[model samples]
Target: MFPKSLFPIALLSIISLGSVSAVDYSETYVGCVPIGTGTSGALYSPSVYIIEDCNFACADAGYTYAYFSNPASSFCSCKNTGPAPGDISSVASGNTNCGSFQATVNALATDYSFQSCYNSPASDDTTSQSTFDSCFERCSTYTNALVAPAGTTYTCLCSNTTPSGTAESCGYDGTFFAYSHTAISSPSLVDRRRRRLERMKRDEQLRLNRFCPGGLQACIVPGSDDSFECIDTSSELESCGGCLYGSYTNSTAPAGVDCSILRGAAFGGATCANGRCEISACREGFQLVDGKCQ
Candidate 1:
C-alpha cells in the first residue's frame, strides 16, 4: 500500500483538505501540494474507517475538516483553518471513501487517548511499518500501559507511562498528535495468527497466576494446555524484580513493584537497578531531577 503521507496534494485540494504544508487551501484549489514532513496528516486509520472518524480525529487536532480516501489504502488527513469560499462542485469531483469491514479495530484494543503529533520520546522500541497489528502487539507486549510515537517515524513508539506538554494546531512536527483509536481493519487481519499468539500468552499468564512458584518465582508456559519461558523478574522490563500481582496457587508468591512502567518516566530512560526501577530520563520539556520527571 502507498504511504499515507505521499497522497498527492491535488487530491487533497479537490476534497477541501489541507496540504501537508499547513497551508489553508481554497475549496476550489486544484493544484498539487508539496510533500512535507509527516506532520500535516493528523491521523491514519485502517480499512469502516469512515469520514466521521476522520472528522472526529481532525476536530480533536483543532481542525475543521478531514479527508478519508482509500484509492489504495486507508488515509485520514486533517486540515486546519477555514476553507475559503469557491466552486464546491468542481472540487467534489470523484472523491470517495471505502471501509466495508466492521469496527473490529476498536473491539480488542485497550482505550487510548489522542491529541496532535508530538516530539516522539526516545522510544524503548519500534514495531515494523507493516500495519496497526504490529504496533498493537509491540505496545501491549512492553508496557500494556502507555505508548507514544517515535518522533516522526512510521512506527508506533514504546515510551513511558504518560506524555506531557501541549499539542500543535496543524503541522506539529514531531510534537504529539491525537488519535480517536476507533480504527477499522479487515476481519482476517484482526483475527490473524499474531492475535492468536496474544491469546495464548494471556492464558499462559493466567495459569502462572493460578499455580505460582515461591522459590524461583517461576511461571508456567506449556503442554497441551502448558508452556515454558518463565517470567524472569530480575531483568524483565514488564515483570522487573518480581511480579506486581502475584498470588499462591497452593502456596505463596507475593506481588512486587513493576519498574518499567513508572508514571511520567517517558522518553524510554527507565532501567531495573538492584530490583528497583531507576528513572534515567523523561519526556521532552520535563526535567529528570531527583529521580523524577517533573
Candidate 2:
C-alpha cells in the first residue's frame, strides 16, 4: 500500500503526465475536398505529414482553417477560411484535404487578426492599443463580437463578423497584435493547452508566495519568474538583508543596515536593533557614535 503522504505527489505526477499528451485532432476533417492553394494563410515545413501536427500548427498561428497536401509527404497551410482564389488542379487531389477543425471544446484562438463586423452599444471601445488582449479576453464572455481590431493601438472594437476596415499586418504596428482564444472548432485540444498554461502560472505564483523549504530563505533573482534561490539570511553575508535585497559585499544593504560589520576586530560587538545596525560595545580606545565605532 502507498503511504498517505505520497498520495498528493502521486496525483500531481499523474496530472502532469496527462497534460503532456499530443494535441487531439480527431473529428477535425471536413471530408476529402478540393481547395485552392493560391494564398495559404501560413506555410509550414515540408517535413510535417501528420494531420494532427498541422492542426496544432494552425491553432498556434491563430487560424481557423488548415490545409494538408499530399499526406504522404506532408505540407501544411493555415488559414481563416477555405475556397481561396486559384486553379483547383494546380495541386494533386488524391491525398489532399482542406478543412476547418472545429474545436470540440470551447477554446480561444491566439494571435489571430480579427475584423469586427458589428458591435453592440455597450461594447468596450478604446484607443489604447495595449489593451487589445484585455478586449479580446472580454469578447470570450459575449457571443455578439468575436472579432477585435488588431495591429492598431488606437482602437479596440469587437463584432460578430470581420469588420469592414482595411486589413492591417498583424504585429506590424505597436497595437494589440496577439489575440486570445475565444472560439475554435477543437475545444478539447485548445482548452487543454490553455488549462495547462494556467495551471503552470498558478503553480509558479503559489511557489513564489510560500516560504523556502529546509529552513532556507527565499531569494528572487531579477528579470526571471521561475528562478528562485534559497539561502540562510542570518549568516549569509551576500544575502544579509533578505531575498532580492542589495548584497552586503557591494556595500548596499538589503532593506536594512548590516550589523555584521561591527562584529569585526575593530569593534567589540554589534547587533541588528529595530532594523538598524548598532554597535553593542566598542573595542579598546574606540568610542561609539551614532551606532558606529569612531
Candidate 3:
C-alpha cells in the first residue's frame, strides 16, 4: 500500500497481457488540502497530490497503477482497476485517470471522520515522538483485538446477546481497531454441553421433588440403585439418615454410616450419628448369632 499522495506524477507502466508494448505513467505535480483536527482541538494535516504524464501506450485493462520511488515506507505505492474508459475520448483527456487519487485519501480520512494527515491536532503535535513510538510499538503486538494504524485509537463495536450466554462487541479505535466476541469453538459442541448440564440438573431436581419434598435437602449419592442419603426432619431417625433397605433392613447408608446398629429400635437414637448408626452390645447380642444371645 503506497501513500495515496504519490499518484499525480509517479509513473505507472503496466505490461499489457501478451504484448511487448509498455504503458508508462508519471506524476508531474502534487498538492494538498487542510482537514480539521480532533475534539481536543489538534491541528489536522493537509492532503497531498501528484501531477503526472503517460509516456507509453495506455491499455484497455481499466486499471491505473502508480508507484512512489520512496521505498522507505510500506504505503509508498498505489494501484486501482476501475471501469474502462467509455471511449478513446476519455482516455485522451485522462478522464478515467488516477490524477486525482487524493480523492481516495480524502475519503479515507473523512470515512473515519478524522483530520487529514497535515492538519493534525495541536495535542498530537505537542506529544513527544517517544510517546508515539511507544504507542505504535504496543499496537503492533496486540492481537486480542484489532490494532489501528500508528496514530489511531481502539474503539468498541455494538453487541447483542445471542441465545447463548456469550456477548459480542466490535468497533474501530484510532490506536486499537475493533473488539468482537465470537465462539472460539463450534456452536454444536457448546450447545451440546449446555443441554447435557441442563438435563442433569433437571433430573436431580425432579428426584428431589418426588422423594424429599418439604424436608431438609437430600442427595442421591452416586453409584447405587436408587440409593440416596435423606434426612427425616420429623424424627432424626437413623431410618431417615440411613439408606432404606425396605422397612427395616439397612441397605444404603450415607458415607460413614453404621447400618447394623439400627436394629429394632422404635426410634433410631444414640446409634445414629451423622447419618450412621452405632451398634450397641445389647443389640449385638439380640442378633442371636449361633442360636444364642452370645
Candidate 4:
C-alpha cells in the first residue's frame, strides 16, 4: 500500500534500530531481572525479557544501576566506582612508563633499622657481625619505592635442618614491622630479606657498571681519593671517591715518573689531573709495573 521509496526508507530505519540495539546489549558488563519477592520467603525468578541492554554513553558516564522499559527505561543504575579513567592509563597526566617509575623511586630516601638475631648452630652459622654491619649500611641507602623504610623488623631462628622451608615472621619492630622464621629447616625471614636486598645491590652495581664501568669503583668503595669515578660524593673521600682505606689518582707522572711503569695494568693506567686524587707515575725511584709500585 505504500510507495516503493517509502518502503525502502522504513526498512532502513528498522535495520538501523536493530543495529543500535545489538550495540546497546554489548555495553553492560552484567544484567539481571527480579521476578518476585515476599517478606518471609523472597524468591527471585530469572527473566531475560525484563533485562535491559545498556548503551555506551550510559556506561561511560558511570551509570551502573539501570532498568529499561517502554521506548527506553532503566530500573537500576550502577554506582559510579573504580579508579579514575586516566589515573593508571597511558592517557594519565605524566604518561609515564615503567622506566619512569624508577626515576621517581630513585629520588626518594628512607631509613629503617631492625634487630637481627642469628640462632643457627655455631658450626653452620652464616650470620656474621661484619655481614650485618654491611647490610645495615646498605639498608640505609636503599631507596626503593616498592618498600617503605620504616616499620619493618626481621628475626632468624636457625636449626641444623637439611632442607630449608618458607620463612615466617613475628614481633613488631618499631611501630611498623614484624617478621617470623616459620620453618626450622628453611631459611628465616630475615635471611630472605637480606638475600633480596643483596640481589638488588648486585643488580644496581651491574647497571652502574654498564653506565660508568671502571668509574663504578667509587660507587662500591664508598669513598675514594678520585672523584671522577664516583657517582655520589657523600662524606669526603669516605663516601664519594674512595673510603679512608682506598686511594685514587688522576694525575700525570713527571717525565721520569711514569704511572704505567709503576701501577701497571691493575690501575686504569691513564693520566688524570682532575677530581679528588692525582698521583704521577711511581714515587721516588719506583717503576710502575702491573698495578703496584715496583
Q: Which stretches of candidate 3 lie over 4 Å from their true place?
A: 1-199, 216-235, 238-269, 279-294
TM-score of each: 0.24, 0.32, 0.19, 0.19
Worst lDDT run of 10 residues, candidate 3, spans 83-92
lDDT tens readout by residue for model 2, 1-294: 122232222322222324334433221332232323412433322234555555555444344455665433355655444331111221122212232321111122333433312222233433333332344444553332332233332244443443334433322222222222345445575567566546534543343334455445555545553344666655554445454443211122254334556533144376543334456677777777776677
Candidate 4 local lDDT, 129-224, one digit each (tens): 222123222332222101111212122112223222321121112211111122222346446645644554454345323424354432323332
Give the residue spans of candidate 4 off by over 4 A. Answer: 1-181, 187-198, 213-258, 261-294
Residue 98 CA error for candidate 3 (Å)? 71
Per-residue lDDT of model 1, residues 152-180, tens digit only? 33345655434455433322233332232
Local accuracy by lDDT, each model: 0.39, 0.39, 0.26, 0.25
Worst 10 residues of 1 by lDDT: 83-92
Residue-by-residue lDDT tens digits, candidate 3, 1-294? 122233322223233223434322222111111111010121111111221211111111211222222112212222222111110011112212212222111110000112112111112111122221122223222222221233332222222221122222211122221222332235574456446435533533453334344544344344443444455523344354533333111222232333444444323223444554444433332553332233
Provide the clashing-pair count of each candidate structure.
Answer: 21, 18, 51, 44
In model 4, how large is the Cα lDDT of residue 260? Answer: 34
Off by over 4 Å in 2: 1-124, 129-132, 137-154, 162-168, 173-202, 205-215, 218-229, 232-238, 241-259, 262-294
